[model samples]
Target: MMFDPFGDFDTNGYLQNSLRLKDPLEVKESEHLAFEASLEDALAYLAKRKSIDYKAVLKTHEILFSGFYHWAGKDRSELVPHLAVFKGSKDDPRHTIFERPDLIRRSVEYALELAANKKRFRERPGEVMGQLAFAHPFLDGNGRTILLIYMELCYRTRFAIDWSNTNKDDYLRALSDEIQNPFEGHLDNYLKPYLLDISSRDEWPEMIGGIKGLDGLDKEGITYDNLDNPEVQQLYKTYRSQRID
Candidate 1:
């Protein structure tokens, strides 16, 4: 089943988009265009911030996607608090489970806390990325939103990722493994070779927008269930008890 948390797909599309587009292809084109247009505004917003917190994360999503999504800045916790979102199926042992709605901010906050230790963040950027990706704060635009935030964090920390040098499928596989088996450095190993010196903030809009597969790490084949559902509750146990060597 598709992840339609809004429960309006039959009439409104995967999301209640700006132009009421019901076709997936059309919605994607329009949404991608809006995202391209907003990159500068989003970066400008981040550039003004003296410090970042969970609230800054929300605002960055708003600026980047408010043109396309009516529910742009709001997270799943506020919009669909009872639903627990996942990739693949809840019953599958291999599925990717995001943080529960109630814990979304806490997860992002933890990522920010980890980022505060600049040394740890630089040494294990994948761990930081994995944590934020697990937060899964928004209904859409997550990959781009998180990239912007991650870029800001990198800029502040004096390091950068050579995104162009990485492969999408490999990066995503590593990220999924990282979320499922966190702190063991699965993603860190994947990202280490791509780490490089920081680039100018002004170069980001063109450089990031020109890149391919930025959205590949985001929503696709997603499904959701009531938090009270037994299987859904069981799946969260993996996250609750996660630790890896």
Candidate 2:
């Protein structure tokens, strides 16, 4: 019952890795490099796709972390069905239930549908982004993966978040608020000020990397091996069948 997911540090207190690096700083540095290198390929892959669905979301995760984690493209439900995850501080923890994994798929699909509307995408990016964050699909890397996907959605709709203008603390706070009260638009309001016309994608990876590489509000992970049941698997199959690509 290890409550801290990122606390699985090796002897040196560096986070343990699916890859060989044992030094925490080295692991962090390597992951940053991996993300920057993979971001272009991920964006290119997105360009060929007609829509961003759950599969595309998984693909983004894969592209971003495949070099660092063998389980990059998989969801928490599949990898650790019995595990529970939480974000936020000890006093006000936000729990994520892996019991009903299909909800993750539904949330992403719902976000994509909302994003399909240029008006809603422009006016309520927070709502869309909040839903995806609430879904919390992966064991880790959800923030970075979703941010890229969110940016891509904006690009398709002809808009982008000026990451340069955004403050990391403020953005994280807004996202936390949105996660807590998802239907509300706290994140949308926070982001509205920074939303700008679509700009070059070329510098986005470097820009986002500098802001707070792979940082997310979610905290803690504990695994329970027997969480998945037949019904959930069926739901996943149904969702998988609906993917556009």
Scored by lDDT, the top model is: 1
Candidate 1 ranges with C-alpha deviation above 4 Å: 215-217
lDDT of 2: 0.69
Give all TM-scores, in the order shown.
0.95, 0.77
Residue 191 in candidate 1 has what lDDT? 92
Candidate 1 lDDT over residue span 1-245, tens digit each: 33477888777776788788776667777888888888888899898999999899999999888998989999999999999988887677788898999999999999999999999999999989999999999988999999999989989998888787788889889999999989889999999998888757867876696666774346577888899988778767756876433
Candidate 2 per-residue C-alpha lDDT over 110-157 given as tens digits, one digit per residue, 9 for 90 to 100: 888989888978988898888788688887677789888988899888
lDDT of each: 0.86, 0.69
